[model samples]
Target: MNLIAKLLPAIALTAGLSAAQAEGDALHGKQLYAVRCAICHSLDYNGVGPTHKNLIGRRAGSVQGYAYSPALKNSDVVWGEANLKQWLSEPEKFIPGQKMFIAIPDARDRADIVAYLLQAGAQQPSKTP
Candidate 1:
């Protein structure tokens, strides 16, 4: 085989790894969600928990049709990066009796999720802008 043929496998492997790392490095939050969250929460629909589509910058307990735990419904906190980070780090600790499960252990992962959520939510609005 030619030199190009000898290098093809290495080239393909490098390209595949780059793409995998790109997807894995980002959406740290999404990975956390899929493992620790998606069982209950979703980006579009409330599973056992609330849908997270526009959770960022949105009012607490204001998803129209979704029923929120009283603790969450009465929560005065607005959904933003800082609050989300704290809340996800320790759901029950953030608000005793919160319906959410245990907080994510990794702070950076939680922040990534929050960033991803904000970005996801911005999709439609940015289109208009």
Candidate 2:
């Protein structure tokens, strides 16, 4: 009974932390994307970078028409929360020799950006240009 009581608080804390990490604000993410990513990327077409529509779960460097670096094009990473977080934190470090150099240092901001990307990607129509 004493062991259970001691373990219960730790379990509750772990659950709370997980919930907090998962609860990213998509609205904030949208704003952050505009400031940080808009210069190089778009949702509907390939600009300086590839379209971000339907980005999650898509394989890295798989978007058509955007010229990708050899390192990125060859990498077999599937986009997901973990991968996105690492990429956002440090793109060059995540995939060496990739063209993208932008990095989001704040973990919370990175989470928000990923959340926004997921939400925006879902809403936007996929386009190729």
Candidate 3:
């Protein structure tokens, strides 16, 4: 009984930690994408940055016609939840030789942007400033 009482709190804490990993809201994500990501990226096509369309699961630097830094071009990184989150959190640190100068900074904002990117290709981008 004594050991079980102590273990209960640990179990509760573990459950709380797991519950913190919630999926971002795609709608709010769209708004975040517009304000933060649209300056250089798009769901439709590439401009200063590569398109986010089909980004998930794609190998880094694989978009056709977009010029990429040699480090990115030669990278083995794949765009998935974990790597994408890290990349958004800190670009230069994520890929040392790459030249991205921006970061989303907030974990929620990053999740929202990533959620938006995952779904934006199937819907029109929301207008935002």
Candidate 4:
């Protein structure tokens, strides 16, 4: 076999994996959210937790009508991908004394959830309180 032939399979596999990782599976993410986060959160309005409608770009603890922990309310954190990943990995560790206790141990799962939130937020119209 030529060198090009030997390299083709490896290159193809690498490309496929990279593409898969680059964009998360939003459908799977929605399912994960339903199972893991729906009880505490909602897309359109505040539930036990704050509304997740426009969570990605919104500042921490800025959701209207929902009471937030002082630690989170005071923290100057913006909800971007990196911050979301860190927060999901360990909420307490990210923001000490915050009310959230759930932690998604798997990095891939966290990524998926964040992707779902991003996609969902984009699909829905913004709600003004």
Q: What local distance difference test score does each model get?
A: 0.73, 0.88, 0.82, 0.87
TM-score of each: 0.68, 0.78, 0.75, 0.83
Top TM-score model: 4
Ranking by lDDT: 2, 4, 3, 1
lDDT of 4 by residue, 15-94 (tens): 99889777776778899999999999998899988988878778999988999999999999988878888999999999
State, as a TM-score between 0 and 1, how close model 2 is to the true structure. Answer: 0.78
The candidate with the higher lDDT, 3 or 4, is 4
Q: How would you encode candidate 3's per-residue C-alpha lDDT over 32-123 as one tens digit per residue? A: 88888889997678989998777877889998999999989888998887788899999989899897789988898888777766665433
Residue range 25-128, candidate 2, lDDT tens digits: 78889999999999989988999988997887889899988899999999999888789999999899999999887799999999999988877876344468
Taking the tens digit of each residue's C-alpha lDDT, what string does model 1 give over 4-120?
999999999999977755433346756666787778877778777878776767887777788788888888888886788788778888877778766767655766676666666
Q: What ranges in model 2 sit over 4 Å off?
A: 1-21, 123-129
Error of 4 at 71 (Å): 0.9
Give every collision pair in model 3: none
The global Cα lDDT (0 to 1) of model 3 is 0.82
The model with the greater TM-score, 3 or 4, is 4
